[model samples]
Target chain A: MDAPAIYRIALDVMGGDNAPVALLEGARAALQAHPELFLHLVGDEDRLRPLLAHTGLKGELASRFAIVHAASVVDMDDKATSILKEKKDSSIRVAAQLVREGKADGVVSMGHTGAAMVASKMVLGTLSGVDRPCLAAILPNMQGRPTVLLDVGANIDCRPDQIAQFAIMGSIYAEGVLGIPGPRVGVLSVGEEEGKGSTTTREAAEALKDIDLNFAGNAEGRDIWNGKFDVIACDGFVGNALLKSAEALAEGLVQGMKGVFKENLLTKLAALLTLNGLKRFAARLDYAEYGGAPLLGVKGVSIIGHGRSNAKAVHSAIRAALMASEHRVNDQIQASLGRLMSQAGSQETS
Target chain B: MDAPAIYRIALDVMGGDNAPVALLEGARAALQAHPELFLHLVGDEDRLRPLLAHTGLKGELASRFAIVHAASVVDMDDKATSILKEKKDSSIRVAAQLVREGKADGVVSMGHTGAAMVASKMVLGTLSGVDRPCLAAILPNMQGRPTVLLDVGANIDCRPDQIAQFAIMGSIYAEGVLGIPGPRVGVLSVGEEEGKGSTTTREAAEALKDIDLNFAGNAEGRDIWNGKFDVIACDGFVGNALLKSAEALAEGLVQGMKGVFKENLLTKLAALLTLNGLKRFAARLDYAEYGGAPLLGVKGVSIIGHGRSNAKAVHSAIRAALMASEHRVNDQIQASLGRLMSQAGSQETS
Candidate 1:
């Protein structure tokens, strides 16, 4: 299969709550599946060597993956500001630096979201014309495809200009990666009607309407999974809440069903018969199914996996990183942003 | 039991996508179930007569549910602003007026949400010290207990004072009505950190930290459905979006499961066996399960049901109204607001 388009994904080995083990296992899984894939495990060499030795890899497989010793690892519980200020040699910071230095195609981290965002921002910097980098999470819709929601946890207090830019980035990601045509972008608001939002949303909606993108005016939160819009735009705070709420609800429902279905003989029988369907449903809702959230608006490809990610989640995250890097999401974002700004300028003059 | 607490819930008979059919049937469901429950159906007499005839209701039900001719109905497709300005004598306005004039114990309208908000504001008025009214919805958690979220769609532009009041109202509703003891109230923000939100949120969080209630610092969107907090507060604009997104996700999951499970013959058999569990899961996530969203800052008992509500939803909404009325939500809100204002006063001085 033409060597599966070899991509080197840098992994922050000591990031998430389930650190090196999950990270090391994930790297192993990715490497086993894609023979051409290379992994740069960024962490203390001593800690990783023992874990890697257990993988029992030989020859080329071992050579393909290497540990780049980092002085420290950013703890998942550390404060974002403190981590950014103090943890320069942390695994997350070093991993991000690898992408910036052209040593890796992308960097994936299961670190504190804020820490990962901060390190990625500091090391790789935001793309030109992008003020802040937004974390875009892909939510599975009924169509079996995914919708990209931006600024899920990045910049909570955003201006209209920033949200407008977020829409552009989200649109590009959805189209460039997800393969949606002429993506419908909607600004998240209270109602679908015009002028039905905060000062920032209202202003962003006005600006978005003038842009060349397939702007669908204001969309309520219900519109996110309704397949009404391909790209849902909002300030990071709202987007983060929506993303998390959706995930939590799905997880809750799945858990609740498991409990309810096992309480009786009839339900147990039902559970057995519905097992495949339930598995499919769980897979559809599983965050691991989609891999990771892309840190859009950044200069380089950076993916943020969940804080509690296991090997499977980390593996999916690496796959997501490969996909994002292949799609050239940043290039599409910058091009779209330029078009949006020019459209706004023309509207002001006309 | 004890005359079932007579509650004259004013119904917007001609509101919603289903019009009088759903509204009329919903009123009948409540009225028939509880003999003490009376419905003041607000809409044109000419249109209502035939609709009632179709229900084949007895003379007792016909007499118990009175049709108050409002001469106009708010179309579901109409703009909120146009509905407010043009439909002066609309069912929503008249229904809200019933609560204002004490003709009805509460008003339940399944019409344009913005129109409902405006009508409730103008007719019912805000609780004495409330600067703005908030639309509060109950989001079902994994634990099966619902969490009340305020500012679902009332005031888009909110100040710190308003959000602080929302927190208080949300707390009271959660405690007094939802039956949570000293409900944990949280301000919805991007981060769990204290000083991480917009200007309004920062001020609101600071104000909330000192409240007598069990104020949990900051909850992200994921925490809303996690049942970690009894009440999650935010500006109406963001609250509405979060509420909608959560609702949409739940609805989408249910719909997706139904379609997927019923897709094949084998799956259909599985669906039948798992039907009870699915139904229970549906009920748990159903918006109608809790009845209606309460207008938090309003003086009177004002519950705004979904615009597309059916008979069961309307019935549940009426029940919600009764609960709110019994709890004296308005009085509690007023008392809470007074405390909040004084607390802010002390903070300002310090």
Candidate 2:
């Protein structure tokens, strides 16, 4: 029988705090779960071969995955521009390039976020008419569904135009990739009221209202996780802060719970009973569930997973990439942008 | 025999979501716990009297508390400027005025945050030489200790100078009220590395390094709850967003837990095993543990607790107010400001 056309995902091996281990596990898990999935492990081939032998999964599945040897690895702590300048042979750069060249469907990395962003921008390039790429992540909400918060950290100083683009990109990602229907887009501001935010934010909010999407009125920081809206758009700086704060609070709650339980026997006994449910809850809150943050505005489906990601997170990130690719997220984003620009021009004429 | 001198706490009856009910219960609870603690309940007598009859604890702590009747009550959702202009008889204004006029030792309110901030500014005023007032809240760390994060939302258009003041105020508050010796202070930013944030943030970071306090340099959003630092300072806008995001995430996690447990039989079984521990954990993560956000840089102790605060949160807020009073936080802040001004002068000269 003839072999099927395999779906290939390029994995950056020399990235993240854990690096090779996370990449190896992610590739292994993906391959084990899906027989048709192929992985292009981009890193030092010599190092990967030894690790692959010990991975326990052998024969056809192991043979399906391949390593495109890259001479250099970007330092996880290096500045973005520094990594760009000196790390031409870096695994992340090569992996992103593979997607750009159409050799792979997607690029997944748990590397230095700035480095991933840099590599994605340089190799994959921005989508048509997109000035800068934005990182979009799925935040767990009161509703089991995730809220797509855009510009999580890509561009810190965003103009009103950039925010408008973010709204469009985020809407497409939520509806197309995440299976949300007609996703409601809300601009993150100081208040939900029409005119209660900074100058740029107010302009963005006004602009969003006129868009073709289901634009909800302004949403405050509290509204992001309230599950009232599906897409939360903001400047990268504010979005980054919001994303980090939410992550910290979620982890802090777990830590605080542990502290409470360890306080005394009564609380400890109570905690023991609640451990399983809490673990399940924690799992839901984990960013890994939604996979990595997709670098929206890039031509290809490029995912930047957390640098601290383990095997499970990386595996989830790969799934996210495939989902994004399958849904033609970038194409939809381009279409949305076209509609927005034409709408703006028609309004100006009128 | 003469009775002991009760520590009188002025309660703003018109402040909060469930106003009179929450105020009544909180006062009753406070008086119940500390027989020597007296509540000078300030609001319209007729409005409060009806609520008191329903509380059922009136007769129990009747002798310990007294209603210092006012003629009018402030609406919890009124505009801050409007309340400041026409509502001299407003409960929050009256409560703040009582503290300023020395008619009461300390004032507690769970009212509209803006109105509370305005009332504090108008009545108590900023500390001598302090340019603006800021709000500070204690975030629970895993070590059973609280980390002070300031500018919780008092001012939004923060200059670098204002952030420096916030840092000073937060340091003193952490050291005194929270009882941490030589509290370490960190400026909240997008990254921890030196000069890894906005222009204003970088300037503030450099400015803080010269201060006499334990300046630990810049801390990222993740480090806010990490407990590595005692006090984290930021611009009010960032602080407000961070604070609200944390609260929203905490609430979302609780809601998610409830949703999961209520999903199916297997999850329900997991929920049953985790009930006691979940409750304990929930209690620990609850914001009520720290009471309220102190309006730092003000001359007197003023705390802005949540508008939806229950009796427990309100009662804790009163205790927080008392702690601020005993710590002489305002006095230390004034001293810190003097040092800051001199540093600025020297920097300009050199």
Candidate 3:
């Protein structure tokens, strides 16, 4: 039916803990899964070329991929803005450049999150009317549908207007990409009441009311996965804490369960019986399932994954990039922001 | 052993989800567990007298407890400062007033947290140099030792000085009450690096260096339960988000496991085999085990438990209040703040 539209993604091969090997394998998996997918492998050609050879792609499939050599790699400790000046030829920068130059539809990197955000913002620029770009993470909720939580770790300190901008971007991303119709947007706070959080949060809640969205007042931290709001917007500092703590808790619980199962023969037998169910449970909480968090408000699709991302995670990230590009999320975001600005402008005149 | 010293706690029996029933049971449990404990049951005398009869505390033990009647109850939806003028006769206020009047050593309430904080601060007032009171929650970490997380929801907008003060108070609480020697204190940030967080966090980190404690630079959200630091401090907004998110995740995971076990007959049998281990796991993550969070920096002990607290949680909260009172946490906090102020004064003169 209407032959699948070709989607191209620039892959930062030399990023994340798994690096080129996991990324190369993920690229292969994505290519195998989607016939219309193409990848620009951005990394050291010497390292990637050999890895590409071992990926076992035949003539037609092999034509779907190419290596774009990058001289440097951004270290985890590198300053977020260092890629702009110091490590200009870094894989993350080169990958974003591919998107900027229209050589690829999107970019995917499981690298230094700060570096990825900086590179994407500097290279592709922000969507029209958007000030600062924010990161939006798709979390699996009890409702089985995904909830989008934004500004996970981008802008540490945000003004009321920026929080409002984040809400609009998050709503658009949720509806346009996550397919949640009329996404319910809520500002994260200490309590669900309008004036129950910090002064910034209170102002943010007020700002959110003036926006053109199905704004659901304030959401508490527990509401993140309680299947209440489709989109929850928070400042990066708070959002980052929640995201990291949730991830660590899930990981720790999984590890604790493993320890529990290994305690005795009877428990071991119980583990065997409940293996599939437990695996499904863990999968629900797994970051790899969601793949990467999209750097929203950027002019182009830029998916940033966890540093500890695996082959499966990389594959999911590429798929996310493809979906974001296909859905034209940035276009929707720009249109939404334009509408908001015009509304404010009209209100001022009145 | 030397005769146990009497520790009197003013209990807000009308607070929490379970109200009088759970509070009565908890008071009984606490009284049974601690021979020298006394409770000033603060609520409507009519409701209390009947419930206290069924508690089975008799003769000398019965004489140890007394009903301190209050006419009004603080509703969950009431304004935090309403108890100051509007609902002055509220159970929570009565409990705190008992402490202020020297009738009780501490106050315990499973009521609106903000109200409890307001009442404690207004009635007992802040310790000598503590300008604001902060909440310190004891979280069970992977290392088997408890980590103290402060400002969970007390002061939403904290200054650099206030955060530094929270660190000092948290360190004291961890050392004095939790019994950790020379508690490792940390400022909660997005990263462990000194310059990695927001302006306030960076400033707090700087302020922490001049304080007299084992300052551990910066601690991330995961560090709350990773057992990295003995005490972690953050603004109430961020800390609340982290605390609530962690609690929800642990709860959601437990529910997920229960669902998995109930899925099939085989899984049910498996659950039967691993019931004890699962219970232990759940217990480890249970808030009942920790009981309550202390409102540190106040002139007297004020413990705030969850609204959903059961008899066990209330009992634990009473025990926490007793420990806090017994250890003279306020004296230690005042001494710490006094030393810091004098140090600052000397530095200014120099």
Candidate 4:
């Protein structure tokens, strides 16, 4: 069966809050676990070489990993336009180039989100029939399955048509990666009613209703954790902010619970007893559990991790990148986009 | 001075999922707690009259409360425009009327949010120079103090100028109600950078920078729970969706934790021990703890509660209404509006 297509992933070793070291450890761990992986560490050789040597990789596994040298850095402060022109040698840029040059099947970056997105857009370009690329996350729902939300900070201001595209891409990701068949797509709005949102959303909702997928009309914020839909399409501005806020709320509750347990002797004992249970519950809401948000609509897989990501998060991102590429998500997206666009064109002409 | 300006609140007893019974119990509880409050229950006299008598209210405390009958109903499905024109005797409309006639200082409704908001807008009208009425919620931030978020489900689409107005109203609410001397106001966006949002927010931020308030610039979703700003303003569509999403996240986490504790014998024992601690932490994130979201930019106090609110929530809503009126929040908003509008206008011309 063609040996399962050895997935070569370009690891942006110099990205994230904890670079070089965390990336080295995470890459080693991922490579150790996955036999069909060949990781190309894209970063400054001087920084990555020492960390990789010290991470205790066996000789056999080490043979599958290689380092690609490039010194330029894309700081979180680097503007997208500036990264495109000035930071050509940035790790994120080089990682994307690996995919463009056919050296890698996917790229994983935890650095400047905009920088990574811009680099991927310019280097790999977008898939067929896709205009702008977007970010999509798999959020854990109450039903024990994950819901996919797209445009999570890839574009600050989204056109109604873009939202329609998001639904298609998000739906594809759900079906291709999460194994959800014909994912129920929903438009994020203040109300479930057709006419109950901003002009952009109302227009998007109308357009979504016209699409051929399993559209769930409009969904409220409460529907997020309630597992109301398989994929929720929204503008980047709202999607990014909402996800972060929900994370903060969940974290605050966990911390507050910790504080409550520390209040007295009796509670302290209880906290120890239920520590495993609390951890299990927190695992449900942890974004790190899903690895990273995937940069969809692009030509190849690019997973964007948190700036504060640790080795565990990095490991998950690598896993996600492999899954996406192995599933041939881009090919699936290309086919789906062709069908939806033709239908949209017919509607427009009518 | 002048008998401390007694706060008389009219509550729509027929509103909410629990209806007249919850309202009767809540009104009684509020009256018992605050001798300064005089409640006028507005609903069908047939439903409210018996509930109040059966709840075991003494003759003297009962003197502080009265029932006003209103037959016309604003069904949750009823359109806002239709409710404005036809439902003249609806409880929400009647309660709002009591405020306009100076018979009550504030009105509380847990019924159809849009209908209640429309009724308040039409009956009480807006304060002088106020272009739109907005909803402001005191969300609990990680710092233990509340963060004021405005235009939450009030206006789906807001102009840049309207955002400026939201900042003014929200600022006044923080100072007049929460007693913050000069609250730091922020425009909720996708990023914390200057030019990091949509055209609407960029314009709003630019105009805000020209004004006198302590504008905290753009705040991402993380800032909501990080307690970065005391007040965050946004278009109602975004604010409502984000808030509901955060709420769902918190509730989900709480429920998830409960499930974890039910796993086995060890977890069951731990659950019993940490149950109190979990309850305490959950209360910190509870929306009902803060009562209701205030309808700011209006002439009189209007508190919008959840349809599923219990007696405690109803009681808290009444308490918030009393505090807003007692502090003369509308007067504070009126004075602040004049200053902001002139500043916004001057910026436009320049």
TM-score winner: 3
Estimate, for each residue in B1-350, the C-alpha lDDT of model 2 and write its tens digit: 98665555678877888788887888777777766566778888887787886775577677767777766656745677655677878788888887888776677889878888888888887788698898888887655578888887777667787788888888888878778999988887788788877777788888888779899988778777678888988877777777877877777666765765676676565556556666766665567888888888776788788888998888888887777776677777887798778777887899
Error of 4 at A197 (Å): 1.6
Off by over 4 Å in 1: A1-7, A32-37, A50-57, A82-86, A209-212, A310-312, A331-350, B1-7, B17-38, B46-65, B82-85, B339-350
Which whole-number lDDT from 0 to 100 does residue B134 have in model 4?
A: 92
lDDT, candidate 4, B100-168, per-residue tens: 999999999999888888988888998897888899878888887788888788888899878878888
- Number of clashing pairs, model 1? 1
Which has the greatest lDDT?
Answer: 3
Candidate 1's DockQ is: 0.61
Evaluated at residue B5, the lDDT of candidate 4 is 55
Candidate 1 CAPRI category: medium
| Chain B alone vs. reference chain B, TM-score for every model | 0.90, 0.90, 0.95, 0.93
lDDT of 2 by residue, A1-350 (tens): 98675777899988888878777877788888876677899999888788886764467676788889988887856777655678878888889889889999889988888888988888888889787889998887766678998888888778888998898888988887788999988887777678877777788888887668898888778877778999988877778877777777677775655665576666556555566766777765667788789899988889898888888888888887877777888888888788777888998999
Give the winner by lDDT: 1 or 4: 4
Local accuracy by lDDT, each model: 0.81, 0.80, 0.88, 0.84
Q: What i-RMS does every model get?
A: 2.0, 3.9, 1.1, 2.0
Report per-candidate DockQ: 0.61, 0.35, 0.76, 0.69
Greater-DockQ candidate between 2 and 3: 3
Candidate 2 Cα misplacement greater than 4 A, ranges: A1-8, A16-25, A28-38, A50-65, A75-82, A100-102, A255-283, A308-312, A338-350, B1-9, B28-39, B47-66, B85-88, B100-102, B256-286, B346-350
The candidate that achieves the highest DockQ relative to the unseen native structure = 3
Residues A65-167 of candidate 4: C-alpha lDDT, one tens digit per residue: 8999988889877886566788888888889999999999999998888888888888889888997789997788877778888888888888898888898
